[model samples]
Target: MAVRHLGEFVVIVCLTLVTSGSSYAEQLPNVVFILADDYGFNDVGYHGRLHGSAILTPNLDRLAGEGVKLENYYVQPICSPTRSQLMSGRYQIHTGLQHGVIRPPQPNCLPLDEVTLPQKLKENGYATNMVGKWHIGFYLDACLPTERGFDSYFGYLIGAEDYYTHMRSYNVGSKTLSGYDLHANKTTVYQYKGQYSTHLFTNKTIDVIERHDKTKPLFIYLAYQAVHFPLEVPDSYMDPYMNITDKNRRTYAGMVSCMDEGVGNVTRALKEAGLYDNTIIIFSTDNGGPIQSGANNWPLRGSKGSLWEGGIHGVGFVHSPLLPTSVKGTVNHELIHVSDWLPTIVAGIAGGALNGTKPLDGYNVWSSISGTASSPRKEILHNIDSLYIAPEILPSYFDGEDFLWRFLARVLEDKFDTSIRAALRVGDWKIKTGPDASASDVWQPPAESGLHTIYPIEKPNQKVWLFNITADPLERTDLSGKYPDVVDEFLQRLEEYYKGSVPVRYPDPDLEADPALHGGSWGPWE
Candidate 1:
């Protein structure tokens, strides 16, 4: 046996020949990764059984029942971070996307040198296709999906856009710039103007499946634009949720249902194309739902942009006829991060090599998901963002008659600077540093309940928070005061991670990216 090093990856070469009856002789399975935008923790029907949610997600529920549901999965707090990590198999700190998302006009994108998941699949004799939102970056043609290892791409270049009009508006300097965002590969597609993105992307996915060559495996990354902002959906889809008084939640539910229907349609297409038997379907959300936009995380605390479980604890599941019967229809509580998908699919499933790639922070968890072994990952570096700014201080639980006194007392004897926004998870313990006074740090319930309650806000002086997530998943109790030693250890770990982080790539919005200047379409300007 000999060991060979390829970039940061290690490959072992066995000198002995393998038997013809080995499992490695089998064909590779097709992969379909569906990513939902701004999906809440409690919005799915499977979670509704415990939270009594009014959202209708029959298709998603059925898919979960036939697969291993990921109850303890984690994503980044925003769109680009999660997507970048999913594509690169690296953390945000490694990719320089540690803070915020790629704004429409920013002269930035995922570093071009990074080896993406699609590229790896393509190397393994797979047809790679991408449909829907490409929010990572588009300032350069090198940043487009087609240029990033995908054979074909159909999607918007930025984040949220009008569902029917297919238009996105953002301020470039003093002017609010608006343009058509729908595209097919590198060309701006205008024919899809009136078509809803959820259905449009779904149809494209089916087309890809129907036209795929059977001899070669297929890899589809369907990043749906559903359940995101804009709050627009056809009225027919919302009729069932008319009971919900809140207009936004009602529309949001309809959006979810429409996406669910699309999922069922895609599955049906796969079956019709004879690809279902060997296809592995994985579903996950980009981040937690934004509470201000009529989405609810409910029992989980915090909203989209915060460092709480509600912001990063995502909905994920894996379904395939290839999975063992013992693992199907089971809930997995093991810790899994979004970055694990790249290696899991490339090396674990496709039997591909990871040569020429950078050091991957992800581990292939196929054995764990397949019920053969426990997860190899025990710790996850959530993030270390130096650019994070705490929201405006408001008079909540942090302010009272004795607030000034307590603030001065804790400030004088602080163990770690709480202003450094970072979080880390080691085994059952999770630690977060930085001020947690963001408006997104509140539990949002379903709109149909018509019940509103105020929760205690984190004290202003309290910069560090420690929670045993396995014991207290809701994160209601803060053990920082009780276990100061644990907090110190986690802080030191965070510091080590911070030292390895590259400079953030958030650049100022460029006027050249204005749609009016680019024939009314958003595309590469550099």
Candidate 2:
């Protein structure tokens, strides 16, 4: 089989296909995909981080106890890239989102041609719906989730929004676009003014489940905005974490608590709807935590946006009442990726095959996840530092004072062959560089609570480190010089993967260059 790139807290469900036989083909389990934004490795209780730690996630812990925890799940370091991979069942590189993110006013979006998970589920007779953040695209009406695949789409379009006011702001060119972004299937739901976003999304998910037509199985993607940024939570939620001391950490903990409550509410709704046991639920974080946002990836190196395990490895689990009773509460050490969910879900529900225009990077990992067979994944392309930027499409500021921006522009526009950062894991051995061999700080978490900040430093002549992750989960030791052959083999594999990646795509520069055309607003919709 081909190689693929491939951790998390617990939430609870077990989905067993009544019989291993095909007699009940029409009785597909309802699929509930719950995604947390900017969550971390040690943040969930099952990871042995919340016992006495500042982090608290009881719902996730209970879920972990009743479900299967994926100890080695992988995602991209950033939000949009991971979301793109999750939806399309391919790497971000294959979906034109190899670098940075899809910021506001940029017309760039997931290519419409790519068939998303919801789209495939819909094709198989499921009532597909989505709630919360949809950061892939929004400039064009066609790029919206409803038009893409989902029958309904609710929540904010940008990467982050004020949880209370549902407002978002983005700066591009000279325009700073700000507006109330809560929407219901492309139309803004103005009546929900001042409501906390976490609660709102949860209530909507429950409502969808309650109102769903039972004749057809449902596919609900509850993508919560909680715990991301603009860190805000209700007093009730924040009150429990008063002992956290640090204001940001306190609020962050509250946000997680509130979201955990929401998860409880949703699962309760499933039971109320008489669909709990026959439903398949998967809970996962979009990406690693960003320290700037009060997130902690304790004991793991690096924060969000870095190429370290802490940045991409997240808390995740698979729960379904139908899952084999014996494997319940088991920890699956199998390597898995966010993209694998699409095919896995499709196969789980109707056993349909992938018919996307491009070949998929995800595999049907149900066998491994269910403990019925070994994992098909052996390696993964962590990240490749390359983007096909179109210079003519960039604003005149391409030559401006921002050196990092300028360097990125050069890489994209000039088609420069520069390997700024790359990592690949073949078997238990992995190799990576800090922005193309220039050393970057390996962030280590403090032993106790304290304010900390990391500043990136360059070491142009720094040596690359290799680790046997199985022997060193913390990635503390460097075995490069000790195992030269392993490093060489992985490097060759990384290069091969980079050579096959698709070019990056961006929005029309003209659309973002004009302040009046930048997409955003602030008034309530009638």
Candidate 3:
């Protein structure tokens, strides 16, 4: 490992760390966890995969320059599941969310029995704060952030909302304007209506940091609603992208740029408050960008909803002065999962292991990030979901006697069946099995200059495909036929892993009380 000196600070961009022998004092380091919703792989400058992206994310690039880029970080395919795993350090199947997200007004949430990150951190004398996008579940007050573990909560309750009005939309043309989404500590604050949500969330985060008591360590979870759907941005942001003729793509770029600026403001606030050096900053995306939302996860396979590489693999980095100066501006190719953050953060502050609790599917990966040790995470069960045919079992999937029966069977039986969609990554090999494995969400480049291509649906395949992901990150060739023994061993392992999983927890839709909110269409309740 080569090292250089920048002023009195040693700089090392790509090397292992030699510990500085820093000791834990009375003032533990502050944590600022920044999560981007549906951010793309190629959208940032550091990835070096997207040849010429219109997006300019200077703040994110700066973060990469200041810290270690996690080259092999993995996350769940969608918002709620990823957030669930992140919060509890467990799989979504164990936590009551398996296939999709938690729709509003449904009596569902992160299971009360499970321990959350904030809960554990609060026990360790940290001020827990959350700003923006808490999509886990909020039907009941107990399910909300304030009731969970966050000392303070400021953000929208449901999924994607109108960037300006903050109203939850049911379809492209219909939105419940009266249904208030924005809130500050469980109370709706509509006065900030018409304000750009991305800016408002950033302002709230900074305010928290400014007013935070310095006596104890702080935990700030800033989840940005940027570059998602319902695209809207200030003219100043979009003006620079006028050369890009694709209007949706142009708006998307502006949104990303606005987010980048917000990140700059956040780090700036930390410096202004003299808390920059004592902070551990984490920047990562919730899931892959959706093509319909004009996101470009190029050179990877799938989109936000599928189990392919694009949907699960995401951007991540950790910046902190606590790490040895020798690790600055480096890249860590260690495998990390969303579930690892809680234990990792806890261990970093509490100075001990979280033993005597339920065994977690995640491991503390701080050593992996600091380059002190190789990643302990050797394999990950990406996901296992069956065809969720809502039409056939609408109310039963959520409520009613049928739901009770299904729920009981799920928890009581060894329900791992052949009819399931799943993916597993162990060592250098990745194996995916399902009816939808071959379905590609990749958007092709346009033949005409300056125009963005439309989203195309790839034909599905029923057979499995195996690849040595380390060698073939693009998954260009299937090695299953040539390596039959390897494929068989992986299949057996996947099956055993599946049988050990808990049943999927379905929230009650309660149709009689509230109708199912359909996307891309709107109608009155039945």
Q: How would you encode candidate 1's per-residue C-alpha lDDT over 139-203 as one tens digit per residue? A: 99999999999999999989889999999899866799889898898999898889998999999
lDDT of 3 by residue, 1-526 (tens): 0111111111121111221233224456788999999987777866632545767888899888889999899998899999988888887756657778877645577887777888888888889999999988776667789888999999987788789988764431243323557888867777998999999999999999899888778899999988789889998998987887778778888899899999999999998887776788999899987766767676677778877787889899998776667678998899899988877777643443465335577777776677667778888888877544323234435676587777688567543332367788999999877644224445433111343544433333334668899998866677877898887788777777766667776654544223234221211223
- What lDDT does candidate 1 reach at residue 188? 91
User: Candidate 2's residue-wise lDDT over 440-473, tens digit each?
Assistant: 2455442235535344343444435688888886
Best by TM-score: 1
Clashes of 3: 2
The 10-residue segment with the lowest total lDDT in model 3: 1-10
lDDT sort, best first: 1, 3, 2
Q: Which segments of candidate 2 are over 4 A away from where they belong?
A: 1-26, 48-52, 387-418, 436-460, 507-526
- C-alpha local distance difference test of each model: 0.85, 0.74, 0.74
Which scores higher on TM-score, 1 or 2? 1
Candidate 3 residue-wise lDDT at 397: 55
